[model samples]
Target chain A: MAAMIERINVLIQYKDLLRELVVRDVKLKYRRSFLGYLWSILSPLLIMIVMTIVFSQMFDRGIDNFPVYLLTGSALFEFVNSSTHMAMYSVLDNSALLKKIYVPKYIFTLAKITSSVVDLVFSMGALFLVMLVTRAHFSLYMLLIPVVVIQIYLFACGLGFLLSAANVFFRDVQYIYNAFTTAWMYLTPIFYPIEMLDKMEWVRWIITHLNPMYYYIQHFRDLVLYGRFTDAAIFWGGWLFSFVVLFIGLFVFKKTQDKFILYV
Target chain B: MSEEYIVDVENMTIRFNLASEKVDNLKEYFIKLIKHELMFQEFLALKDVNLKVKAGEAWGLIGINGSGKSTLLKAICGILKPYKGTIRTVGTIAPLIELGAGFDMNMTARENVFLNGTVLGHSRKFMQEHYDEIIGFAELENFQDVPIKNFSSGMQARLGFAIATMVKPDILVVDEILSVGDYQFQQKCYGRMNEMLQGGTTLLYVSHDINSVKDLCDHAIWLDHGVVKKSGLVEEVAAEYMNENR
Candidate 1:
């Protein structure tokens, strides 16, 4: 054994702790709710119906089988949104454990991100059934799921790790994150498409360039509605961006997590 | 370094910010952020605190509420990194910092034990192997399937303690976790603590329970206002502490 320990080694050791915590999070959530896990898919369905109707009028391009189109975005976008929001609150929520044990503090944030992805799996199944019934063209590109899932997981974990750790010290990060996610929904092409952004001459391309969510929403749009794999540039670029954000988030989180026991 | 001392905290200093008195002071906020001055130190929780705990040693830290006892334990556990100084420990460190710290109330007692055991540094396989032992120690055999939220504070504490000590942490850092459980459970805990001590686990106990300290500890340290006032044999130090306060 080396005298100096690598962080990666510690992270690997604590992976089991992360899994156990994620399981508890998922089980604990549905324990009391009347509908339990069904709400994962049902809520998306309700939102998708309303969004399809709303966006169809706004864009005037009325997608055939628009509900399924809306479902694709709703299901995919929910994973990103829920993961970030849950991650922001996770450290605060797990304060009791956090102050006691010194496992990677980021594990709590990752656990929230993981649980949201599990719910995302459910949301995807609901969309798949809708697509099958509607007879939409499904293709081999759907196999690109492993790529998409990994990208979204890294993307959400990065953002969640950053926001949750920030929430520990800044206190206002929680409120700001809540507001940012809601406002961020309109800014992303979830309900709309790339065509809308093309019309906005005043909005800089820089905005989408900076936001990783834009790339993810685009990949989601490509996979489900268009029955195509995302552009190779997007698949790689989005992952690279997520990767960098994860490192940055980890640096910030490790530096500040010690202060959480007091603030939280 | 290997003579028997399991814990070595040298000049450990912990600083934490107090909740702001002024909510609308954006001026203060920007100034603090920009200055980031070390001297602007908002609150000093622990300062130059040093100690050593040898193998099979049961040492207790006694102080009034908010006297930095918990802060010291946390600093030793690496939950709070000291602004100055180092804490080097041998073997695994299990901190029973909060009674139900890692537990989710909405999950079953059984569910929490596995998860809680993991947080205390036990592998899931280790948990699988020791599942029966942990539940047996907690005396939660019949109610393993029930959500922990329905259990009383004492039951929760017992479960937390059982899972925490199950890993046989080389150095156990406990902070006021004993107060939550009833007398019987506390007795069970004391027996467990004694067993761990006999097996050569270093115990770092932080509590306001003077008698508990007097009974279990071979050495006692009195922490007042983030600094140590006394550190010596249990009887003399505890007597001095009692006299100073009285």
Candidate 2:
């Protein structure tokens, strides 16, 4: 924990460096692409449309403006998903940075986590406009943004540190990691509301308690769409899990950082 | 009996575990993850190595490409850990292992220097205050605003080396980075080392340049297969290492 605190101080000290790296990362994907920034806005909208159609047809529920529901889930899940994926590879992607520079290793993941927030912020703006037109109430729970972002950020940073280390020695993690995200999405209560999980109490409880994404998305819905006030239990659960994942994630990265230069 | 010692490395060895798959593919990796048994084939990069250098001392590590010269430098800087033994250093340590690392190529030269300097452990205030001196040292005043991606590797090397060595650390770790800087700048670097020595900074330099080793180093160590094969005054140690290699 003392080490974690020291690393946090390092991140704060080098905040500008992290910001510069985040800007470069965001630009690299956009600049390399033909469409530039439009890809960020368009891709999520496109995925939401396809998901709405596909899932509506599969579930036989006529999709009932499922576009909005799918948009919310997609928006939230993509934020978490990209955050996690980037966090996992942040160390690997910045191996040169890792090898040469002597700062807290977590800053790499922190940069990724911050970049995920940027992506989230961009798409969520578009999501907000759509929700406004569709008459979804903008509840005060939306103030939960700061708290929820921390939840996702902590979990992402934790896994980012963990996966980046594994990636150094194992080349194949980047690929299997992609598939894991897809499967991981279904495990959380994202596309469908939690009420839909009424019949399967056991699965519902696990999704709520065990899945970190569940808290991330649920926290958002509780404040944004659901109109229900924040629950003490969910808030604390998310807080605790975030720190735990963060603790182990950073520990693994620091312990393994030395070996990366050799493996890479 | 020499009383002064700035860098002390005691019996350091580093071993790396080689995992099974050399190629990266999703299918094979997932399969291996499910197997529950991942055996690490191990190899040692460095073996028992020991040395001590005091304040104002300039030393060089010389070896062939595959020898653990870089590994030993990293160990001394505390960036790497040894499977056995201990490494101790006094004062703030800065490593110039690879020039232009942690530098975002997309950013302007000024921005990169700021971030790079910060990672190298200079405060933002210090970077700001010394900003002019830094640009002057790198000699990129005309193009400080330009992105480094557009610059040549030589330009990048000049800028990075200038920024790293700018700190004037008590203990400075230099690898083969001098090779990247051109002839004039190499002389400049030699001059810079002399200035640091005047200011009382200990130097640990690693290079293939026997001439530079003979000229700049007070002491030299010959590393062969990660062991300190020879250690003594620069001429004798370098002569022995160069003869053996030749």
Candidate 3:
């Protein structure tokens, strides 16, 4: 308990450092690029167009507002995907700084996730643009979007902590995570309707019940596309998954961080 | 735990495990572990080391290459954890372990000053107030907008040193950062360090240049092979160290 409070105190004391690091990450990401920050919105919009063209015919379950449906799901998943990937490399990328200074080790991972959240907000503009173009339903429930995003942020932070700490010891975590995310993206139903697996009830059940991302993406779609609040189970499940993963991530990271200087 | 000592390290031991074989990936490491084939040779970087520093005192750490001089500085900065002991420090620490460690080369010099300042735990408002002072001290007034990558190495080091000493920290831990710039800049850095010392900052400096160490530090420690060979006044330890090298 004392350690936990001390950690929080450190976080508070270094909040300014965290902000600067996030700003640096966001800036350096777009530096020297011709399109610069435009790519954040454009890349997702372009992916939605291609995926809509290719997968629209194959998995057309007569879902209304397909572009809105696809964009909402893909955008949320992309946040988790990109944030974790960036967080995974956070420690190793800052190895030089880590070896010299005493900044909290988890601060690097936190900064990466925060910067990716900035990108997520930008990509969200693309979602709204697609909604306007497609003339999708608009409801008061849209304000709940930030709540879902915050939940997803917590979930990604947990995974970020776990992966960044693991990466310090095993350089192969990056490659393995790359392959895992590809499989995870397919499993999350970003481009397809979950009901398409109706014939395989067990598979559908596993994806809906077991996968944490499914709850977040589903809640996001419910709010943005369907104009309704998520079911109680999913609403609570999203929070549960986020806190549990965050707890586990913090536990593992604290256990392993002391050894990080030796490896990094 | 006394208030007099600004830095206290007691019987600290830092150990590293040198993996007998290089295992870069998870699969190979797990396989070796399952088969009990993973071997490690224990290496002690610093064993049973102890040091105490009072406020407003300057101490120099001198040793040959691989003699744990850098390791000791790192341990004091809390970058490396001790395997078998405790380290307690009072007050803020400004560690210039290596200049430019926190710099983003792609960022402009002006941006880096803010970034590095925040990394050292200064508030954004404080950085804003001291922006011109830091820039002026580094003497890069005309190059503020240029990316750090475009700056020469000496320029980068100067910016790093300037930002690090901008505030008088309670404890300053420097590790050979003064070796990068030209002789004139080195003198300038020494001058700034001297000013901070006069302001009652405890300094722990590591340098191979004995003459400069003697000039800056009142007391010194000679570390040889992770052990304290001799430690006393600057003149006594410096003479012993020079004689042994001769």
Candidate 4:
């Protein structure tokens, strides 16, 4: 308990540093682009357009408001993708400063996650624009979006801390993660409805019960598309899964961080 | 004069275990692990070192290249963990090691000031309160809006030094970062260090220049091959080191 308080005190003391790093990341990310942050909204909108043209004819029948569904899923997943991938290299990238002074090592990962989450918020502009185009209904269930966002954020933070620490020892982790994300995208049913997988009932069952992103994404779809909360079990289950991954992430990060200076 | 010890390092040792054969990737490493082919050779950067620094005293570390001067400083700054021992320090630390290390080359000098200041654990409000003072000291008011990449290395070093010293830390760890700047800026940095010293800041300075050490520090330690060879009055230690090396 004392250790936890000390940790929080450290975080509080360095909060300004954290804020500055996040700002630098967000600004540096879009610095050279002519469109600037517009790209954040545009990239997802463009991906949704392409996916709509390719998959709309098939899955559009099964999934209502297919564009909005794809937007939310892709945006949420992109948060995880960019956050984890960027955080994976945070330690390696800041090796110069890390070698010079003592700043909490996890701040780099936290900074990466903070910037990616801000980007996710910008991508919401694209999601809402699509929702307007589809003339989606407005309801109080949309208030629940923050809950889903928190789940995704915690889950990404967990995975990011885990991957960033692992990458310190193995550069190959990045390449492996790149391939893993690609496969992970297909399994999450971002483009197609699960009903489309009728022939593969076992795959569908596993996705429903086992996959974590499925709950968060489905909760998003439930709120934005169908205008309702998910089953009570999935809602609580999503939070549980998010915190569990977060716990493991912190555990691995704290365990491996002291040895980082030696390896980095 | 009496002394109040503010930094204590007790029998500290730092060891690095280097892989004998480079395993290029995780796959190769795991393969080697399974086959029992992984080999490591341990290198000690510091061997059972002990030191104590009095509050507000300037201590210079003198050593030849690769003699663990920088390693010892890093260990004190908590950047390098010792293999065996404890370093207890009773004050906030600011390190000027590899100056401008936190800088983004593409960002303007003004932006980097805040960025680097916060990286060093200074609050944004503190930086805001002292931004002009930092710029005034760096003499980069005209170039504040320019990207640091375009500045000469000396100018960048000046900015880094200025930002780091904006707040007087209780303890300052300086590597050989000042040598990159011109002689004029170097003098300016020395002036600031003198002022800081006058205000009761303890300094752990590492430099190859014996003259600067003799001029600035009252006490010195000469390290050779990962161990302290001699330590005492600055002039005596430096004179003996210079005489032997010459």
**Candidate 1 positional error at B151, Å:** 1.6
- On lDDT, the stronger of 1 and 4 is 4
User: What TM-scores result for chain A when each predicted structure is judged separately against the true chain A?
Assistant: 0.89, 0.85, 0.97, 0.97
- Residues B1-246 of candidate 1 have per-residue lDDT tens digits of 634668888888887765444322345566766876323436888889889877778889987888898888877787788889888888888877575668777788888878887787678898999999989998989999999889998888888888888877788888778888888888989998988888888888877878999888899888899999888899999999889889
C-alpha lDDT of residue A226 in model 2: 71
lDDT of 2 at B189: 81
Q: Which prediction has the highest lDDT against the true structure?
A: 3
Candidate 4 error regions (>4 Å): B1-4
What does the interface RMSD come to for each candidate? 3.0, 3.1, 1.2, 1.4
**Candidate 4 local lDDT, B7-99, one digit each (tens):** 888888989887776564798998999998786678888888888899999999999998889889888888888889888888899999575
Candidate 3 residues lying further than 4 Å off, grouped into runs, are: none
Ranking by DockQ: 3, 4, 1, 2
Worst 10 contiguous positions by lDDT, candidate 1 chain B: B19-28
DockQ for every model, please: 0.56, 0.40, 0.77, 0.72
The worst-scoring run of ten residues by lDDT in candidate 3 chain B lies at B16-25
TM-score of each: 0.90, 0.85, 0.97, 0.97
Flag the better candidate by DockQ, 1 or 2.
1
Q: Candidate 3, residues A114-161: lDDT per residue as tens digits?
A: 999999998899999998898877899999999999999999999999
Off by over 4 Å in 1: A1-5, A57-65, A204-208, B1-4, B18-28, B31-42
TM-score leaderboard ranking: 3, 4, 1, 2
